[model samples]
Target chain A: GDKVKQSPSALSLQEGTNSALRCNFSIAATTVQWFLQNPRGSLINLFYLVPGTKENGRLKSAFDSKESYSTLHIRDAQLEDSGTYFCAAEDSNYQLIWGSGTKLIIKP
Target chain B: GGIITQTPKFLIGQEGQKLTLKCQQNFNHDTMYWYRQDSGKGLRLIYYSITENDLQKGDLSEGYDASREKKSSFSLTVTSAQKNEMAVFLCASSIRTGAGQNTLYFGAGTRLSVL
Candidate 1:
């Protein structure tokens, strides 16, 4: 079984729309980090959470340690938001377990 | 903000040849990592260093050697390139985690091709 699993392997959203991405962890994760890999292959850090929620501009993320899951929500999606999203969890040993990833395409 | 620099944005090598990749970070972070990403696959950890002169093997450490010669730099060497092998190697660094919470800063990555 995968230690970290991301939902909706791919997503398509219209500009100005809102959508959510999710990641579930099978291990006892202590912290979680989300990243967006742009077309240029640069992985931009989005959020780092520990059993709580954090918001940045048009993005919001939440991590639930007890439930072993994390969610990333995008508001007012734009063309530039198109890319692959990844969520990684840090376990007790301080090692990261990454999800396969979700490819998102925001159409204009 | 600090930056992580990876040398040789692209690398081409022959089968059985040993290739080396270098990473330098200006963040002065204590932990550095190396990950391999194949086309359409998730990133897999190859090796990590907690401090200078320290090395830890990850799940995919076989055939790979890593060294942390200094606090600001880490290097990885592929003992032998396999024919038709292709992948992107990513380098990342993070602050020491005493509370178990730290975010990783990544470099642009180095694409490797073996003929």
Candidate 2:
């Protein structure tokens, strides 16, 4: 079963544009985390949230545990932002489930 | 400001052959994990350790063996490689916040292919 489902499996953005990626959880998530997998295959943590929202430079992430959903917003997309974005949900039982991921391609 | 090092960035093995992957972390964290990522799919946990000698099996632990002999190092062994199997194995470590909540620091990943 897919506990964590991500939308827009693939996305393309022009330079200087914006986009949003989403993840919906079927289970009760107590915390959420977002990561970016770069071309070098390194998984970098972008945001770790308990609830509410957080903004890090051009990237902003929001998690609503009550609604069982989370979102990541990218502002002024740059070529360096071209990578795969993933969101993972953590339940009270300590189970961490991941979404399939959204592959974002930033074009020139 | 520490990094996770995964040895043999790329691995090639024959069917039915035993293979091993190694990971080393310098963050002195208390928790470590192993995950497998297939093409177009999310990562699946294979193993995790809470401390130097505690090992826990994950959802995808079949056909895999793990060891946490030392606090800074963890190793995974493939019981028997399956033909045509290809996947990327990621190693990560984290400082326990509470219960199981953590922000992971990952290695560059080990790309494996079976012949």
Candidate 3:
């Protein structure tokens, strides 16, 4: 009965491979946001979605409230992208529920 | 084009002692929030303020107190430093445009140590 669940808790990839991280929610999510916690422990906002898809550079994300899931795809992974990725969902009451996170390590 | 700064990046206290963490934002946002993050657990909201003098408790508000003394600053106090709750505390802020919730920005976070 997890409100927000993230799959593949941890991931390891070669420098140039691609991968996808997923989040499934039981709550009626109104919005979704993706974040990256870098090695220095800085929580950097990567993407914000309402109900569709968005692409920023090599990072792309999609949120489908109808299906109760979200996805973040990383293309051509690099050493700098080695960090933890988290997805947070906002409900109708304007409260956020966070996914545990996906620890990604892009090996050189 | 703003920054959220959390003071005393690291906090250490004796068990059952009172500890305080401070957050200041230059974005002049309307909403501010406090969240606690454990090692493997995701971030959990503790408190939030919509306006200058308003305060609302989040899911994990127990044993924690927060203050929105002004529009630019918010402070959180640990009623009693317990070893179980020793983790990183994150402070964030966002502007509510009335249309919807805007992007939430977070600080570097403060790591707490209970001795």
Name the top TM-score candidate: 1
Instruction: Tell me the spans in candidate 3 whose CA falls farther than 4 Å from its real position.
Output: B98-101
Error at B38, model 1, angstroms: 0.6
lDDT scores for all predictions? 0.95, 0.94, 0.93
User: Model 3: clashing residue pairs?
Assistant: none
Model 1 over residues A10-89: C-alpha lDDT tens digits? 99999999999999999999999999988888899999999999999999999999999999999999999999999999
Model 1: colliding residue pairs: none
RMSD of 3: 1.2
Point out the worst 10-residue segment of candidate 1 chain A by lDDT: A36-45
lDDT of 1 at B97: 64
Candidate 3 C-alpha lDDT tens digits along B3-95: 999988999998899999999999999999999998866899999999888999999999999999999999999999986557999999999
Instruction: For candidate 1, give the DockQ.
Output: 0.79
Model 2 iRMS (Å) reads 1.2
Q: Candidates' TM-scores?
A: 0.98, 0.97, 0.97
**What interface RMSD does candidate 3 have?**
1.2
Ranking by DockQ: 2, 1, 3
